[model samples]
Target chain A: MSEPVVDTTHEEGETRLSTGGLGRTLLVAAGVVFWGWLLLRWANDWLGGLFVPVGQPFVAPATIESLGASIPGLAGAFDALAFAVEYLPALSEGLWLTLVLTVLGIFFGFFIAVPLSVARVYGNLSKYVSLLYTELLRGTPLLAQLFVLYFGLNISGYVPGFLDGVFANNAAWAALVGFILNSAAYQSEYIRSALQSVDTGQLTAGRAIGLSKVDAIRYVVLPQGLRFAIPGWTNELIYLIKYSSLAAFITVPELFKRANDIASSNFRYTAMFTITAVLYLALVITASRMMNYVEDRTAIPGLGTGSGR
Target chain B: MSDNEHTYLLEVDRVSQSYGTEKVLRDISFEMDRGDVTVLVGPSGSGKSTMLRCVNRLTEIDSGNIYLDGERITGPDVDVNELRKEVGMVFQDFNLFAHLTARQNIMLGPRRVLGLDKEEAGKRADEHLEMVGLTPQADSYPGELSGGQQQRVGIARALAMEPKLMLFDEPTSALDPELIGEVLEVMRDLADRGMTMLVVTHEMSFAREVASEMLFLDGGKIVERGPPEQLFDRPEEDRTASFLRRITEMHS
Candidate 1:
């Protein structure tokens, strides 16, 4: 005589269960197959070499020696792994140079951006002036700016002789200045958005507690704003790392320039270029991880979390 | 009107404010002594909150004078930051800094503005936390707190400033009905300690229980003002009587 019971509570879960597990498994399998295809295609030569029988002459040693002697400086297609191993020392020197430039560019750029953003947000006269500066820098290409600083200004005698005496004729100095100013314009925008994202009531709260406007901004507003800007700042930092390659045009002898030198000299363009690209990937990944750690530590619960970039 | 050369703790004379063409407060005048609690009761859009905001100069008066402890705060020469230190204000929305914990919120004013050392600021913060019975929640962020607890922390933050006069602008208006009692209780304790206070609120029961003087404001002017008992039991104006009747009926 008991009425049949229905379990409507479990129906939604059952429907989701039908699609979720199969979808996830298919996605994972597709990812694996895609990466497998990439590895097989890119590493075909190395994998084929590995399958070659040991002590079996694929090519006569005398023939290779004769070729090397006859051509003087000619080499056939490069083994990327072998090229990477042999020239690791030279590549590392250039990598260090790239790291140094990136560090200086981002450090100085961030410091400059802090004041620029503050001026735009809180200053009367400076806000418009900062806006103009930002527009000018952002509107032009970084390459053109570098050219203007290094070739145009350096040669035109527009810059003071004394200033040139301090920083003149140095491609590294020109590249650093160009990169810093360029990144500062971008970083300032990120920081400005962060400052605006902070609740206006926070400023009011600070003032209500008797803090002068400047003190409030310094102690209360900036701390929250800077934390909010971390993700965007890190993105800019990675961009700076990749952009450091452009310094080669000005003869900064950075990672890309060194790789180019080695590649041209050895005629191993594919190997050297691929290795250099991987190095940049490593640098960007390390920097992103470090900043993520910082973001986690400084995160104020419920305030800056879940804010969209 | 009793002018014997003694200054009240707060004095607002003919203060008026307008936005564009709309006058929010007009000729709002009131005075309170060192240990008086004056409650301003009015319907929504009646300029009660604006009047309280004017007292702390959170909103500037268009044409009037506001004196705190006999010092004219309305003068252009007066340092608004310095005046803010002596006059504490609690907002309607419990504007505690979301990034700061309750203790840090209380300590910021004393440390940064008052130049108190960290230890002294921390000590004062705890004292205020205890005053509001929020000592256990001192480390909680505003986002983690209930509405009532957050408002209590707001009060503690103001009290830590040790202002000469306190202003409460609808401090409990944003809280849920069940949570309103806790905030009102903390305020009642402050009134009992003879703190000079000006409050804008719709809690007629709290006003009747705690206010030494009650003001009924309509439009931009005070319609009636007297002791809470006299104003509630025997209104001098028909508008005041009807407003109170409407509020009581709505609450009941």
Candidate 2:
């Protein structure tokens, strides 16, 4: 019985090790492909497309022919690679728009969130106002919100003249506005929890030191609470990066929209979308690493680690 | 504003407070003059902390009035912030801003409330940090410092405001046995410098040594009040005597 048990444990360990190895190998492959693609694009731009031609689907006919003749299985992989190389420029443009939408949405959302979270935590009757705003925005779908802003509001001429020149088109502005509102609602919830997690003694100590209610919050509570909110804010930012794709429905030519257009035209949805997915994954991984750096830099010695009182 | 000569730095008259149905402080009243070190000692939930909180208007009174520097502070019309500027408080938990260094915590009040420039505030902060014997830990965050050092920073933060009266809500109650002495030493030093302080604590030794007057509270009321020696050696009330005896035994 003991020998059988040992054999079973050995089998389980072997399976676990193989699976872990495979996952690590896949991750390394993804990183290499991402960096290689970035370097190729930069080199192509700097050298004026000496290696790979610009503004056309890059099909290296000689390389594909030779590889296919050697191994019939290599033909499909080469074709997919050609498709990705051809459409990456358009996809890169879309990715830039996606980055802008997510960054600005989160940035503006934060300003609104700070006041909303403060109102929710400290206001008298105004807390209910904040609650209503958060609930209305969070309770609905982001897609529906974009549709309402773009079709209902923008077409109806309700969008103000001040933002006319901010974007190339009205739909992008609508998407930006919708994202700001939706993101603010969610970010305020994170901030509210963060503010509440701070010790009440902090407020007492603040007031005791002759700080007015507002000053105490501005100086003491907010600085500490905002640090606690960093992890939550990072999560919101990642979610926003992915959710920016929803703006595609409203005709905003972001990353997902560009992918959809190219895939639909070529009828190679699987190949086109696989590369698109990789690009997004690369983006998200980069964002999370940056946020991790931010969290570490801003972290106090004992906070969130249960070391400080 | 006339320079009115008042006998007391702080005066609490017939102040009562309750949290919902449970009353924490009932008609509590006290008066402290300049250079006075008054300590309130009692069992837990007996309103010692509440009394200290009420002095600073941190806890609103259900009735009666509190006056600091001969100015009424309890009314709605009075500016609570300005009133608070004359009263500084230290807490049992230290409650130092975790994100800030010891020096920054001390500089906060002077720079924000007192409208002092950065250089002036920094100088004041260093002075208070040196006074608490924490000048070496000036750049350390509260989380990086030991409990005793953190409490000393808390003391320094309060002292930076240069308040007329200082309220301490069990400043050493949260410290470990080894750490408590260092905090008590800082408090003793403050008292020796003629700072008017009102403290709440169960440290009978500290109260006996440094307290000019002691009030024994039980069941939301003062059970005994007199000099520390009177309350400790010859309590007029059995409740005070028994509570003191029990607390002393526990500490020992």
Candidate 3:
């Protein structure tokens, strides 16, 4: 027998490791300084372009008053805020495209991951196959995978015409497929580990109650495994959101791609890139919060006890 | 029925088991009639628990035949899951599903394996929980309950299956000394109600009061077997006498 188990509630206080608030505040300040320096360096050309027509060198302004004269609306109480708001409408289409792609990619990937993970952990014949699939997908980079499906298969004429008509016409579809395959590889690992973490005694209890092995896994093992997997799955979800920007390499016209086009044309690289960065940050934080809420809701008290400690 | 005829609810014939080169049981055999409560007493490392586990096929025997309700239970053709439905087991550890409530734990076998409707299973869970005197704790999870309550929930969980035979592998061993009686009290009541039970336990007093027969096992074989009073008062074997004396003195 193992050492006698100590009660979980008593150990919780000593076990918790606080994430210091001061460290996070300092990191935030560092990010602000970096972005501010980029903005000041590029402000002259960027502000000049908004006033003058194309192909013209508008006068550079040394003072706020002269800069305000360049654009009519810049004379407002908050010029920077006003400027960011004005340019926001142009990015909406690309932002919407990125959001849809991420949602569908993650949804389909998670759907595939559940069965693949079960097969890997439990199935006799399918276990080896699932193992190879996960290894091949996870071993390579997501960007390379996207390129293979988008350019190698579609543009190089390997894909049949009808299939190409469906997946090749849009870079977004190919990127979605890449995200699905990549995320499934990563998610399946998280799921398999979670399934293994559940106590073996639970399976014995299930079988003793006359449940067949499959039924035992379905009713007893899976619900607990899913709860345990939530924290890891949330990480995969956030990574998928960030990696969606890689779709821009294939001309998907996602948020990052639109930012690139807007910045290059307007000569306002700092402002456009900073806005896109903030939007991505917002998406990541919101997703993390939503998943945390789900983790709390599904947490079974006194179950999987002593694990956190 | 003829005078010579007796219905054997369970038969363990020439049962032998081994782990690697270590022989755990050697040519062990026993027969249990309906409504028999046979308590197996042995020192640690003896094959008492192994024999209990073999009855339900939890531990596969290397060479043996086990018959349950006169049907061959050890053969390849046996549906082990179906066989398990008729042979309920309670572990040394309570082994209740930690996440589920006591009521849910009891209800699971009936609902999932017996194919009882939810309402029917729910009602059966209530009856079984009451049988184990744990009706008040039905809504509590196993983790929240004390060792005794958890073990009772385990008993209720097995009873909800309504099995023909119940195997208890040191059911009270994991419990605290004070908590042992409540579990034993429930077992005594079960015996009174004619549940055929095979129990591996060191609770000799309970065995003396409730057991129809007693088997003293040592070195992976039955050293002595007979009625509890005969084994307790006038053991034929010197090893059995000393072992009984040692345990009795320890208890006193």
Best by lDDT: 2
- The DockQ-based CAPRI class assigned to model 1 is acceptable
Per candidate, the number of residue pairs that clash is 0, 0, 0
- Which residue ranges in model 1 land beyond 4 Å of their true spot? A1-78, A155-169, A306-309, B1-4
Better of 2 and 3 by DockQ: 3
TM-scores, all models, native as reference: 0.82, 0.88, 0.82
Q: Give the poorly placed runs of model 3, Cα more than 4 Å off.
A: A1-77, A155-169, A304-309, B1-4
Per-model CA lDDT versus the true structure = 0.80, 0.83, 0.80
DockQ agreement of candidate 2 with the native complex: 0.33
lDDT of 1 by residue, B1-252 (tens): 335788989888988898889999889888898989999988788898888877777788899998888878986788888999998989889988877888999999999989999999999999998988887777777776788888888999999999999899989878889888889998999999988989988888988999989989888898899999988899999998998888887765
Off by over 4 Å in 2: A1-73, A155-168, A305-309, B1-6
lDDT of 3 at B154: 92
Could you give the TM-score of chain B for each candidate, in order? 0.96, 0.96, 0.97
Q: Can you write out model 1's per-residue Cα lDDT over A207-249, one digit (the tens) per residue?
A: 8878888888888899889988998988899999999898888
* Residue A270 C-alpha lDDT in model 1: 84
Question: Of the pair 1 and 2, which is ahead by lDDT?
Answer: 2
- What is model 1's DockQ versus the real complex? 0.35
Please name the candidate that would achieve the greatest DockQ relative to the true structure: 3
